[model samples]
Target: MANVNTAPSWHAPHAGFIRVLVGLFTVAALVVIAMTLAYPGPDPHTIVLVSAGISLVALNIVAFTLPWGRLPRRHTFWLALAQLVITILLAGTLYQTNNAIPLLALIPVLWIAFQLDWPHTIAIIVALGLGCIAFWLIVEPMPSRPRVIVAISVFYFVVASLAILTQANADALRRSRAIAEEAWRSQQDALASAESNAAVMRAIAHGVDAAVFFASQDRSSTFANQRAQELGRRMGVSAQDPTWAGHEVYGPDRVTPIPPEDQLLPRALQGEYATESLQWVGEPGAQHAVSVSSLPAVTEAGEQVGAVIVAHDITNLVEALHAAESFSATVAHELRTPLTSIVGYLDLLETDDLDETGREFLRRAQQGVTSLSAKLRELLEPFEVAGASPTFSFIDVVDLLRRRVNHWRESAGTRGIVIEGPDGSSRLQVPLDRELAERMVDAVLSNAVKFSASGGRIEVAVDTHENSARITVTDHGLGMTREETRHAFERFYRAPTAIRRALPGFGLGLATALSIAQAHGGTIRLESAAGAGTTAIVEISLTQVGVAARGSS
Candidate 1:
């Protein structure tokens, strides 16, 4: 059979004392009852004395029990002291009557040893010994029997002392273990809470639309989230493919690796910190903008463990910043025109007149004023569309182009630039904002006339394509370079060649034409080369004519 280990439940430090007291009293009571029944003494009331002594001992045990689960220091002290006093009294009384039991006298001493400290135990033992000596001297029937009583008392004290000391030591150990177990459980709970909070923080961080990376002590990427993977793709870095880990960034591909001394992971591992925003060019044709931040994960002792990197995409932010800068430049360019006109008019009016040179200067001043007025009108056109959405209406492309061409025909005639268009040919209906579409065609034709040399030929071609109508304005004049064609749609972007030869004209006509085409879900494209002719093509959809009205109802 396997051995089973068991222990007493709910044992106070003084429980052993209480049990011993109860047992001694019960023994005394049973002895008294037995004597009453079997011996039938002359004064059977003698058994009553024994019973009373037992009752007193029982009372002491009850007192000890009353204090349990209460304050330990006072309860233990009082319990041990009362038990000692009651045991000594009862045992001394019985001994004086020639019925002294050394075992009974030893009860309080053993209890004191178990419940209280060693000094109290020793005091209890001394008191019990003194009471035993007094019992022998005053109440023992035979003087010669004193030695035997004393010897028995000494033996009882020794046995009780050992038992109490052992019990006290065991209780102390149990208390210590209880404290340790409580501390350990508290630590475990703390660890679990910390881990839970960390998980929640990590989840929230990764859920954001920014790249997140965690690198190990060795600087290898341990965790790369979705955003991180996407950024890596743009930067020509891959989690699956081995490469220089520190090179993972948002911008263009780096032709050379970052210096080891300046690397984020290495510095983080070395207990240093670094983070900054950088612009880089990716492989061949990559242009990505990013802001990167890195920090070190440190231990409790402040030792660096790992590193975390967060990369945020700032491409849109970069573009918006650029747009604001461009707008500022355009505003300056627009203001220059009006300021130039005022300056020229002031100069011509102040100068002495009545000569050919002065007359020519006056003519130039008038032209400058006219150019400034036109520039202000173009600058205000975009804001007009801001409050009013485009209204698309069906109109014949040939008629529209011809009407706008004829409107500018007298101006073209004076400039010796022939504005021949539509050739009175086939009609093609196109979806467009009627006013905006005509203005777009007029702007292109006007530019063709303005830029063309005297006697230059300008052609307006209106035709139908796969799913849309196209308006083409071709001019045999000074052409634009490839770079100019690319930026032709930018407001205030005048071609270098055109700016060198033309009068004062803000480069907003083509940009406005392109914006109108886009508002109608259409497009405008330019084809031109230096020394070669230029063509401006505008295309609009048929559905754009009535889609807004259909959606409104």
Candidate 2:
């Protein structure tokens, strides 16, 4: 860096200031010459020369006062040349009177060289040389005048050349230094910006409701956010420690500690990315159920440099899942036991000594019992997510959608709502378990109607394909926020709006729909915003359904 204080008080003169000073010097010379001629009664040659000299000095002063701003910058070159001519004429006169050496002729040459470029400087130098030679030839001189003039000219030429060259290098150096300084300032700004961004990221991590920790590959350094540090303290160790203190990390059972070798940080540092490694942290009362995900920090060249772990407290989510499962198991168990007895009674009631109507009623009752039993077992099972996928069969999905839309019309009519869909004989055969597929379709439709405002409208479209199908259900409903949409398919995860409205639901509808779709190798997504409405997009694959159907069969 350059020090600003190095510049001296006596700075170099500006070109305009130098011109004014030159004018003033001429005025002083004219005053002294006029005073000296006052006593000599002034000879005619000398008198005419002094008069010409006075006019020249007056012209120079007039130039010094010229409104240079209105003039072209190039006019300065002409001005300096004009002064050079006047100086030479006056110098020749002054020489005649007192044999004075004319040093004033060098001023304009230095002025041009200092303020202008190489071309102007060269012109000034050449003009000065020609003027000096002409002056010598015009004046009466004795004894080897040519040799004397040549030696004096050579000396002035060397000094002027060196001075002009030095000025050019100084200008170039100043320009280069300015560019370097600008580049340095830009680099400094970029570095400061990077640090500011880094600080913001750290603050976000610290404020988040999760534990974030990182460890270097060499295990020489570690970074941890507030939550991570808090968790570490509860577990009797610092988060910076690569290894946990004792067996503080418990498995999903929450009773047994995980092995040291199976720990998250250790494995992650060794290039293992452990995703969704749910574990219990801290002791008993203070224990938190956390879903830990460890990612190996890798370079573009595929080398792992270190590892980072992010863990969120999912204690409430886990507890809710368990409670819902327990309730489902209890309901299924109670209903199944009573249904078995009802089936036995229906079988015993069947007899030949019955009227045709009575026998038909008995058969219908038995069929109802069988169907109800199967539905309870499949839908209410606590471990349904882990169970085998239902069997698939060829079904007209378009017809199914048309019928479903009609079925919901009655329920919608109760709230002055309208449900619309395909009406004509549109046939699309897709390999899907009819009951399971219907359940999934019903779940989305139910939510559409249940969450919709009174007098809302729903548009259902069934797009047909040879090997797939897409069902889009758009409803003008009390829509969900981004957070709600993200966790909409989480089992027993209800939106805050639904809870606030006291909506009657177990929050299992969309969750069940998601499971069924995924089991059939399909995709389901919801698009919604608060008070805007919801659009549920469901796409099912015929190929995946075909494979599942064949495998089950």
Highest TM-score among the candidates is held by which one? 2
Q: What tens digits encode model 2's per-residue C-alpha lDDT throughout 1-553?
A: 2333233322244546656755665774585467547644445545755666676677677777776655654567776776666656556555545544356655666666666677888777777777766566545355446665775577467646754775587568657756777666666666667777778988998988899988789877778998988777755564455564435778888888888778786678777787888888888777888898999877799987788989888989888878878877788788988999999988888888889999999989988998788667544732564475678888888888888889999989999999988755777787887877887888889889989999999998888555668889999889999999999987767899999999867677888888888878797999999999999988888788788888877
- Model 2: lDDT equals 0.75
List RMSD in Å for every model shown: 22.7, 12.2
List candidate 2 segments past 4 Å from native.
1-145, 196-316, 331-388, 455-459, 465-467
Q: What are the per-residue Cα lDDT tens digits for candidate 1 across 451-537?
A: 787888988887777766678889988888889889887776788877677655677788778777777777999888777779998
Error of 1 at 350 (Å): 23
lDDT of 1 at 161: 63
lDDT of each: 0.66, 0.75
In the predicted model 2, the residue pairs found to clash are none
